[model samples]
Target: MTGSRKSADALGEAETIALRVLGFIASTEDLFDVFVNASGVSADHVPTLAEDPEFLAAVLDFLLMDDRWVIDFAKAEGIAPEVVMQARAGLPGGDLPNWT
Candidate 1:
């Protein structure tokens, strides 16, 4: 079905974006250390964890916590900052129900 195909494409795009974010984080020592500490994920295990959509969502969550980080990342990746949020939404468990 077209809908399912679209969903799969979205998932693939999200995963690619998340992997880019992971690379961005790993690009700097300070950022990498902070992410590893905050995530409680061993540096050696990042490759394994990167395969999980939930973990990728968390990576986006972490990136969203700081506007400067988002700007910098977006600029570095030559993408609009809004794309990060869109990618996050495409990931698993990204649709949190609104309580309002």
Candidate 2:
């Protein structure tokens, strides 16, 4: 689905929030636990979040701006440079009914 540039911009913000949240975790297990404890989201949401370009870029921006997490997310999440481009060209959030 297509959205106006403004809507895309908002999604970018949400993606940043999501990524910032992800960046806070200490490990993969912490990541899994975060999703497990999320109000209505699941672990599968990670890939969905990753596929959101606007969001991913915002997320990456968050990471880049935060010296603490910049290298950690890249290292722990196995986020490669090539995948970073795909992340920057992402779409939006997922189609899951219970998005949170």
Question: Which candidate has the top score in TM-score?
Answer: 1
Best by lDDT: 1
lDDT of each: 0.91, 0.49
C-alpha TM-score for every candidate: 0.93, 0.31
Segments of candidate 1 deviating more than 4 angstroms: 97-100
TM-score of 2: 0.31
The digit string of per-residue lDDT tens for model 1 on 1-100 reads 6999999999999999999999999995599899999999999999999999999999998998899989999999999999999999899877886354
Q: Model 2: which ten-residue window has the lowest total lDDT? A: 91-100
Q: How many backbone clashes does candidate 1 have?
A: 0
1, model 1: CA deviation in Å?
Answer: 6.3
